[model samples]
Target: MADITVKVLEPAVSYDLLTLDELKTILGISTTDTSEDALLEMWIDQYSDVIATMCNRVFAREKVQETWRGDLPPQDCARVFLTHYPVVDADIESVTCNGATITDYEIENRSGKLTLFGSWSEPIVVVYSGGYLLPDEAPAALKTATGILVTGARSEMSRSTISGIKSISHRESRVQFFDESGGSSSGAGAIAAAGDTVNALLYKYMRFYV
Candidate 1:
């Protein structure tokens, strides 16, 4: 596989996976409370980005132009992977081999696979739009993960001690402990270290390319 170059033709969805009202409700804030509106909005954006990064997938729909070095897969399959998925729709704007436009191709939207009919020149370029078009279209697991993260962050903020401090006393005590047990403790048990339950939920959304 050659290096793939991707460019976003349109920005990803501007709205968050969780609406302000939803987040406020989860945080137990009264609907009339506007004081923390801005702060909550910031947290939503930050956590959304974090989830996408960790999952190696984009949650919002957007248009993108991608280019890859021409190469066919093993077993004679002329397929290539697109940047994001599950693709919103198989609405490919254009397909180009080198500089000439080609039309004989098929798209597997959910998997981001593009199968070209015949061999082409050096670089294969494709322009398309993919991903969930609306927040409601996002998988329920993703939304639930976002909620967990937001709730955990809010709880951390309410603590009077320093952010990571486990205890506050005169005697020297470890604020953060590492368990060498290498059991579940190394996994979900380390929620704060690995972003709570979000990563586990995001596993299904992960996208891979060859």
Candidate 2:
């Protein structure tokens, strides 16, 4: 699988152009030409302070989750089970490929690059949406997420608030968020007779959205 890297850059052909404020917000920056390492160090230092404000401010909205904790409408069995909490900068992080398999590698600094990493053991299905890579690791606090959803119009900018299993990219479209978990029996989407199982998951999403 191609190493999928989601970057929020300027519009390619001129469809979506980010506003100044939106770009600033996404940058989480205040206009500076500081060294990348210096910026990263500052961000790492402020990670917690920013994340606290975000969990309450940015993501503050109606939310709910229906996993094994809730009842399944069709079979009444556990709809989805969380194998484990996705870890960041750790042994078991999600690859850009929507982790259906697992492996180990030493975490090294490809620091010469801008990145955010995430990994999930089980693939989660979203309704009117799709699966997401848990945004466990971020460059800064404002970039982190709580895996919750926000109702109403969600613009491209207001992303940390719009939630699911967590994703690194806020500007997610078909091209951006490719369901690489295709043809798998389990993980994110499971096979079911008459598609009831998928429908059931969708139903969970509807409830969350509504």
Candidate 3:
């Protein structure tokens, strides 16, 4: 295994996994209610980013260039995993190593794994377009999870003033809030300690990577 860095060449036009209308429907807010549109939009963006972070993958399709650095083990030559999954074979523009294009490679469309044939060099770079189309094309469960997350955040905000709350906790359930320094009091722990339903919806999509 090696260190992988992904750089977006053309960022997705929108990172929204759930649309404004969809969110409004979840919240039971009328489509004509313009009073809270700004606030709602902010929450939508924040929560969408949070969901992606939690899943360790973006749901919006974008062009990207990924680079691999450091030494790779012998077994790694046969298979290298890409950061983003569900890659379409046609979306892979190129895979290069040592400044030359690699033609003897097979792409695992859904898993984002690349099987390289014969000898391979270090510092492999892969250029590809992956991820869901988003909002409209996002998985149904992901959209449901987004709605749950936003609704939970809204409910928490309505309960008390933000300045007075350090973290969210109820009974045995707890979710730590990051301080001004962007570090949580819990040190290394889950960013979201959502309810059982929310957790269940997100469990399958969760990715644990180095």
Off by over 4 Å in 3: 71-77, 161-193
- Encode model 2's per-residue lDDT on 1-210: one tens digit a residue: 111112222211211112223333454545453434353343333432333332221111111221222232233211232111121243222322133432322222221111222343222221111111212222222231211110111222243344333335445542233343444566332122224432332332221210
Question: How accurate locally is residue 8 in candidate 1, as Cα lDDT from 0 to 100?
Answer: 86
| Higher-scoring candidate on lDDT, 1 or 2 | 1
Model 2 regions more than 4 Å off: 1-53, 56-68, 81-210
lDDT of model 1 at position 196: 40
Report the lDDT of model 2 for residue 31: 46
Global Cα lDDT for candidate 1: 0.73
Worst 10 residues of 1 by lDDT: 181-190
Give the C-alpha miss distance for residue 187 in model 1, angstroms: 14
Clashing pairs in 3: none
**Of models 1 and 3, which has the larger lDDT?**
3
* Cα lDDT of model 1 by residue, 13-123, tens digit: 563777788888887899799999888889888887788887776768888898887454653446788876665344788999889998887888778888888666658
Quote each prediction's TM-score: 0.76, 0.16, 0.77
- Residue-level lDDT of model 3, residues 1-210, one tens digit each, is 478888999888888888999999999999898888888889889988988887888778889999887755564465677776779889999988878889898998877888888777777899999878877888888889888888877765664455466778899999876444235564321224455676788888777754
